[model samples]
Target: MSNTIYKNGIFGPNEWAVLEDEADLPESGKVLVSPDRFLALEGSAPEGVELGVVIRAGEKAERLVAHLAKLPMVAIDFPKFSDGRGYSSARLLREKFGYKGELRAIGDVLIDQIPFMIRCGIGSFEISHAPTRRALEEDRLNEVPIYLQPVGRDGEVPLGTRPWARRRVA
Candidate 1:
């Protein structure tokens, strides 16, 4: 699954040149790759190739905390929409480990899931299906405003400040 649209299509000029398995590393440019490739390179990633990692669904994203400083983007897979583990992984990366990079949700991505993903601190979405692309493009996806609780590491005003919200910062 590929062809990502960041910020629910609200932002642009963020087009990514993602590196897939068995692909050649570009001579110069930011690139996103899989977790195995990042770990395989150790801390010696090729110069000029900005390194990013995509953690598969169900994988332990926390394992990469030590290397967070080296990453500008981290994608957590959602191989199946029913697999909700990526939500936790995303939260841990943002709230606990303090990952400030572009946190992406990839694979099996759907329009309805976008709002929830954002609440979990996912900043981008890798949308491969045409239906998802259409929904997002048309702004038909469900929108959840006035959250009762801020679930991730976002700058939500504290409980007393916002009557309808309570953010638990880890």
Candidate 2:
């Protein structure tokens, strides 16, 4: 992915390095490890490296609850555009677990799903899709103004008198 990340409404170099399961850990840097690796190194990761975890679609979000505070970033894998499990994982990490760190969506991220992903509390995206990346870069996403579901996020106002219908604050 060339260390390029779209985050906080800007495209910038990604500071976190993703580590392969068989790779050796670097002494100093921000690193994102797989769920299993994260669990194994939970209390014993190298002190110089800031740790993060990438949760796959099938992994349980609760597995990282106790370590949320120490984690600066948590990435949920979409795997495919049809897989909606990452959305729920992001919501659980943000709302239920009270995770205030960066929630990143990785793998199979598409332009059409950006707005919905934001509503679900995913703040960053690691996009590999060429069209999606182009849309993001050009700021030409066709976003829906109204939301049919209440995601319990701040700055969302109810549309008319219907509590279920909401719009994001500009």
Candidate 3:
């Protein structure tokens, strides 16, 4: 019943602990905090504790713009498969704000949407779906090789002179 954390092209353990609003911060560990808590803490957690923010649905990623440089990780909640706002948030964080740290997606992460998520700059995923977990564990995900829109990530080649049509180089 453990959740699988897929990162850097491999499925492994989740190292960061998610903290509730009322929970006491650990003295030394990686912790994911809500936006309000993150703001309240002002990006300052206990010594030896790495701070990360979980940007939930309906929350704007811009709120974290000032603190992006200090954050080692940022997890965007999917909440549901149909909610695509996290994609835009990821893109903005990577492309606009230039957040080079680990961008993670949590909840409702499906195999079909993983490729697209990667394109949007999500480097890790906290996956709970059994089928998706199996796909990652087996290294057999169904994905489209070609992409029409450019996401500004490396290894994406333009298909032709159109400038919009592109394909992933991998």
TM-score of each: 0.75, 0.87, 0.87
| RMSD of every prediction | 4.7, 2.5, 2.5
lDDT of 1 by residue, 34-123 (tens): 777888876576677788888887678877889898788898889897998898898889889999888988789888788888888898
Off by over 4 Å in 1: 1-3, 11-24, 145-170
Q: Provide the lDDT at 2 for model 1.
A: 31
lDDT per residue as tens, model 2, 78-99: 9999999999999899889999
User: Candidate 1 has what TM-score?
Assistant: 0.75
TM-score of 3: 0.87
Residue 167 of model 3, lDDT score: 56
- The lDDT leader among the candidates is 3
Using lDDT, rank the candidates from best to worst.
3, 2, 1
Provide backbone clash counts, one per model: 0, 0, 0
Alpha-carbon lDDT, every model: 0.77, 0.85, 0.86
Worst ten in a row by lDDT for model 2: 158-167
Off by over 4 Å in 2: 1-3, 157-166
Higher-scoring candidate on TM-score, 1 or 3: 3
Residue pairs in candidate 1 whose N, alpha carbon or C atoms collide under 3 angstroms: none
